[model samples]
Target: MIRLSMMMGRTAAWVACLVLGLGAAVQAGTVDVYSNNVGGDAVVGASPTVAIGSSGWYYSDVRVGGTAGIDSTFARSGNGSVLFQGDASAGSYKADVSYSTGESLGKLSDLSSFSYDWYRSAASTNNGIQAPSLRLLLGVDGVYKGALVFEPYYSLTTPGDVATDTWVHSNIFDPNMYLWSNKDLPFQEQFNHDIAFWKSEIGNYDILGVSSGIGSGWYGTSIAAVDNIHFGFGEGPGTTYNFEVGAVPEPASVVSFLIAGGFGLAGAAYRRRRAR
Candidate 1:
């Protein structure tokens, strides 16, 4: 009887450890920066529009004309993703969307990493490889400092090019990953540089927010979507955003759900072990 009791205690402890381990595996760094389910359908642009979405996020079709909004037809995670469609047949158009983070996003030199998942529809007719560009809004002393841009066309890393109808994860912060600052310059003159180089060149810079979309020259009515954005600052775990359609559980609620599930699993494990 003593040996059986000891075995049961050990089993329970092991089960508890397993549950805790599972919880630890869940990404604590991830944050739902923008989880609202607004603008699920495409909004055709008659003229350039700004601040087109709820929250601080805004959509712009400044280049030519196209559509921009949250889309439900395809998503990398959850039930939706921000979609951009550039018009080509009529004229060159770009679909750009941006989010103005209410708070200062820290300095450029402190930015440790930036990544996002993007999808290019097979129907898109951009250069066989062009998808979308990740733009980081920059400022200094509360003054605008144009955007720091990263486009797959200039990337030297593997999976550096866009593949239509498939979601591709792009980590622009990787060393040697090419990027350019479009401040006071034309796209042709904005030469590509690595993150380290940009940091030095930009001097004192503050990250204003993040923007991603398709266009400028992505002609042929190309379509693309972006989601799962992450920005790491100064060696920290960083912030992550998972765009979703419709209401999502608050962070606390999600934590409670996970804890409850873990406890339930532990109970089941305990019972099975005792039955033995």
Candidate 2:
């Protein structure tokens, strides 16, 4: 009788701990790219260093890194906006965001989808269009493998259009919205490009770049104002969440399940002993 009593007590305590932990440790998560509060003192692509959100980062390309900043005059949803100004000379600049898991670095493959909002006013002096782009880069242990490229709708054609100043939402994973640079076109391709690298054995990173001279046409001033960004994990109508720059996921969920299992086994043993 005492042994069963002790077991029941132990199980009750374990269940209590789990319930408390879940309430205390569970966090609302979201990967926010930029907002009204987030801005920088320097212009993106032209400046060597720029602010991503609250924690700022550096930017540099093969040619040179430019400036990136937040714009107060224009904003879609928030009071402020993030702006990237193109450099006079030709070059591409990229700013890498820091995201990781408990054991491994977070890669593009970790998330099912990512999206952002932006407005662009650009013109191409050269034959090709040098525009700002977002990418999911894949590499093996460190060596570069490939990237999933996303180009804005207005930037694809030769003659650049003046942005209506209204904000637009773009989901990079959606086949209709984004295009792959090295891979074959979406759906119709004999092979899937982005998926291949994303599922590869190596780790990958995410990069946001504002290019000057490059692809289809070279735009001297690809003046762009961007805001409201999100990276989704198993994201959909009900499963998505949002997190800031510094926040990280905790292991409370796993612990909760384990504790619940222990309680179940203890209760079963108590019932069987009582019957006997």
Candidate 3:
């Protein structure tokens, strides 16, 4: 009887360890970053000038005069950095670029959620004002054919005053508010719209696009810096099973364990009755 109880305890402990190990595997997540450079311009699907800063960070320069019409662009820095700075124009100076990872990973689907810390220099009257805007775009085959635009909640018009780099988190799931109220649909809807638009415009091709430009304008008036751009599929932190992992255990294993435990307890009870 003592040996049987010890065996049962060991079995239970082993089962618990296995369950914990499997749980950890399922909860794993991954992050990747792409730095915009001149040589690898094709990687991002658009050709933009590359600028190497003194800090050793490669920046994509899309000046308003360039073929791609970007003043300057930098997605990820050399150290896997997430800081970005650029200028935009209301009329002519616009930086349109896209980053793609191709496919989704289960429920994490594509980057359905995005959060970034950003701030803009006050808009300048002489060198154009920087009323910075934020936009999220989706890419397919390296092209940004469309986007879902987010309006500028904070505008900086004062010179030398820095806009606070507050972390802003947004989920592109509210279609009614995003599309109807803001005159723009959610990210998924925007993607669908671009697909139909592309079918009509380019015929039989998948639509690759973005969420929208945060600060859009002409004349290099809109200057802004952004950092910590995080993209993920499910909800951002603090929710049950928000980022759950792996498959459930086999039903047979669970049933077998239950039956075995019950039998062991019954045997122990019978022994006690016989002794009494």
**Clash number by candidate, in order:** 1, 22, 26
Expressed as tens digits, the lDDT of each residue in 101-219 for candidate 2 is 21223454466656666565534232233334555544444544445565564333344543444666666655544335443212332223344344353324433222211222333
Compute the lDDT for candidate 1: 0.70
Across 142-179, the per-residue lDDT of candidate 3 in tens digits comes to: 54433344333322123343334333333334332122
Order the candidates by TM-score, highest first: 1, 2, 3
CA error at residue 179 for candidate 2, angstroms: 3.6
Candidate 1 residues 72-142, lDDT tens each?
A: 76776777777777777757777777777566678888888888888888887668768778888888776
Residue runs of model 1 more than 4 Å from their true location after superposition? 1-27, 33-39, 46-55, 61-64, 157-161, 185-190, 248-276
Candidates in order: C-alpha RMSD to true structure: 7.5, 11.8, 14.3
| Total colliding residue pairs, candidate 1 | 1
lDDT (Cα atoms) of all candidates against the true structure = 0.70, 0.45, 0.36
Structural similarity to truth (TM-score) of each candidate = 0.71, 0.49, 0.37
C-alpha lDDT (0 to 100) for residue 216 of candidate 2: 27
